[model samples]
Target: MDERTVRKTISQLAYCYAVNRRVSDPVQFSIAGLTGKAEKIFNSYPSYSNWDVNVSNKNLDELWNPKQIVYLTADSNNLLETLNEDKVYIIGGLLDHNHHKVFEILVNFCQSLDWKKAFLNVIPKRKGIGEEILSEYKKGEEITTVLIMLSLSGASNQPPGTAFIWISSILAIIVDCLLIMTIGLELEKSLFSYQSLLNWPLVECIFSSLFAINFFISIWLCFNGKSFSDDRTSYSLAATFSLANFVQYTLNVIYHVRTWIAEQKSAMQVIDPRGVGVTSYGGP
Candidate 1:
């Protein structure tokens, strides 16, 4: 997470807290592990303090009982049916990336590198952003490969609407590449005057939704144009990939939508009079 993400999170938290108050739900929102950008954001924004947000420069365990705090993660096998009104739940600070065992492993390994002695023949000391290792979830490779096959097969085999398939496939590649560039890139700030108005899931939702329609249209053309019905191996292969990508895009849309909604709900639902941390992480 960068300063922008952390700032956005605090802003969203404030928004949710206000919403909760409007509904007569008393909730205490706490932010722990305040350092670097986090501390700066907290201190600079008097509104946060005014909002009655609990701020701390410590870890969750240092401030709260371990058993009372539930740290939410995607890979947790223990499914929590519902939120316990008495318990405090912690959500990771980053918006797109979920912290799990794998993330811990990578972060630990990265942190260890800075401790190695240069002439000890151990791994050389280095400092780098570990979370960047598992940045964005992507299905572009499979999708792009499928699109290529579809376009090529249609063109070589001379299927009906071959031109349409080729043009659409090319456009699809452009969209996929655009999505890829957004990962670990500052295009939002550089390209848009209002960078705060943009976020990953929203951008992803738009792309996936548009591509879902694209895939649907392509699939329809495939069936009626005999791209799928053709007896030739080329057309069948193209149709197969096209269908697969369509399903993938649809799933992408559903996944992003669910993620966005859950974020909103979780942000608004954490009600604690004493206060509890939402998450702790690096910010720029």
Candidate 2:
């Protein structure tokens, strides 16, 4: 897994720990098969080293008895309906949209190892994933800004309209951040669940338009340049960041449209590899 995926996984594990600990009976978890980027994150983050958790670089088979290992795959007919404290269970990761590759390879690998197979009753949900990280990063940014604003007394040195630009940028950032969280939360909602005040598609459309417009406005503000050197630096950075957001936001809008089309046609399609097209490509 990439670093972000690893971090997200660790976060999920931490959330599970938090939830379990709050219950009358708690469970311990051992996260095995740590390697590469995942290992680095597990080691670096104190959160991953929870009270009842173990982290190891060794593979699951090496960490536990293979005879007791019940390697859980989604395709398994058997469902693990009950929880046993002593049973050794291994859960597979996300199912690829192209189903055959993961299924076949997983069966062969499990068969070769002769490990048991069963499906877990619980599946991971994407709704709250990455939420902790987003909150943390936002907190860090706000605290840093507070410190800087407290230390620097540049109100008089700033340009005439600098406060307006700053306020606009800050407001835009807050709105966009909330939009991102809302999108993640509603990712698993039913296709036509549009009764809510703000659905995912509507929020995406608003953010996409706002991001593009914000990019142009920031550009205009920077070039018009009534600002001092410090104020101009802020304007320049705002324009740069705005343009970057607009580029990525354009991709988000493309995906939103393609998903909408797929729903209408009742045919799910894999998105084109990046650099090929904006939407799904029927051809390889």
TM-score for model 2? 0.32
C-alpha lDDT values of all predictions? 0.52, 0.53
Name the lDDT of candidate 2: 0.53
Candidate 1 per-residue C-alpha lDDT over 72-121 given as tens digits, one digit per residue, 9 for 90 to 100 = 77688764433456787786665433222222222232333321111122
Report the lDDT tens digits of candidate 2 across residue range 1-284: 66677677666655555655654544455677777876787679765554676767788778777787887676787644334456676755432433133233233333332111211112122544245445664565455344223222112223234465567666767776676666645645535534455555655646654664564455444443334455555545565655566566677877678668758655545565676655454555
